[model samples]
Target: MWLPGNTGVYLPQDDTALLIDAMLLAPIPRGARVLDIGTGSGALARAAADCGAAEVTALDVSWRALAAAFVNTRLSGRRVRLRHGDIRKCLPGRHFDVVLANPPYVPCGRGAPGRHSPARAWDAGPDGRAVLDPLCDRAPGLLSPKGMMLMVHSTLCDPEKTLVRLRDGGLKAAVVARARCPFGPVMSSRADWLERAGLIEPGQRDEELVVIRADRTR
Candidate 1:
């Protein structure tokens, strides 16, 4: 976990841990093809490889994140193909039996706007769906039939919307795991904005993170 300071790479935090826990609990078929979206520190991808996935492709829009993942996965003695891109853009029409996601879901305020800033790892525009919505819209296509997707994000992004979108995409989706944790630095700074935007209540200091499992069961 030697993340370079000021590299704009996301550190493995609560959401990442939650997703890993959910992924481990799920029964990943032996020799399954797994794809880790926004691979960040590559933790989830490594876990998938260690858990029986024969092929694990970790994709991220930030090359820095991919670099972090490349180093981390190698350090863990896991073989994960690091891709410097995204699943939404079509990885040559590749489909995975398992897809892991820990995308940005925090509603970004004015302080964090630049695409290269560290906040890119957490900022998800006004409604926190800048990335989540797109991911939900395209996830079903990225998944193979009978495949399962494990995505972790904050409740601020409207889990109901995500569930509905996935279901609408012909996938069975549900919130499988949830955790209530205190607001981190980013959220702590956005408390006022979030309150004004009705994403959180006044004096609310904690946020709920949920692990949603969506299955493409044709």
Candidate 2:
């Protein structure tokens, strides 16, 4: 996919690919209405469109990211509605058959990401639930009955917590896919701090990324 150069837009990475693979394996109904939250470069949105989704809405807080996604999706011959806004606030009252989220799960001491900056693409607060918590709480309300949400995050943030949150929200949730990825620059730089914060092992250099599938069975 074509991405903007140094435009503060997140380029697709291992997490994106993992999510795409899970999405492909999912039994998304044909012509499904799909929502791709935190769509960095529209990779997941394009994948959903290519997988035969009738309508795909891609949301990103970064305008640059949205522009990149728009370009990439259009280049792929997919019609995706690009929205520039936060996932928590955008498209109020909207529901979808499938919700795909590749949120920032990297544990950071920065508290929260700023409105602009590439760091916003992957810096979640300490324990990394800054975005994950809200997403889990909002997912069920955004999903139609029997709809499923596919979310990807790092184990550093506690995958079990995510599962419990989703289950408490009335979804049948489980880890559908997992990949052990070496520490990226951000994680590598913060390894010691993460260990000190008790978020990781003392010498841990790799983090496990898990793709969780939560089905709204109600």
Q: In order, what lDDT does every prediction score?
A: 0.87, 0.90
Clashing pairs in 1: none
Model 2 agreement with the true structure over 1-218: per-residue lDDT tens digits: 57655766778888999999998898678999999999988899999999999999999888888889998999989999988888788789999999999998888876665677788988888778889999999999999888999999998888999999999998999999999999877789989999899888889999899999999997
Clashing pairs in 2: none
Best by lDDT: 2
RMSD to the true structure for each prediction, in A, is 1.6, 1.3
Q: Which consecutive 10 residues in model 1 have the weakest lDDT in total?
A: 109-118
How do all models score by TM-score? 0.94, 0.95
User: Tens-digit lDDT track for model 1 on 1-218?
Assistant: 55665666777778888988888889788899999998888888988998999999999888778888888889888999988875567596789999999988899765546656677778888889888888999987899989999999998888999999999988999999999989988899879989998889999999999999999887
Deviating ranges (above 4 Å) for candidate 1: 4-6
Model 1 residue 138 distance off true place after TM-score fit, in angstroms: 0.7
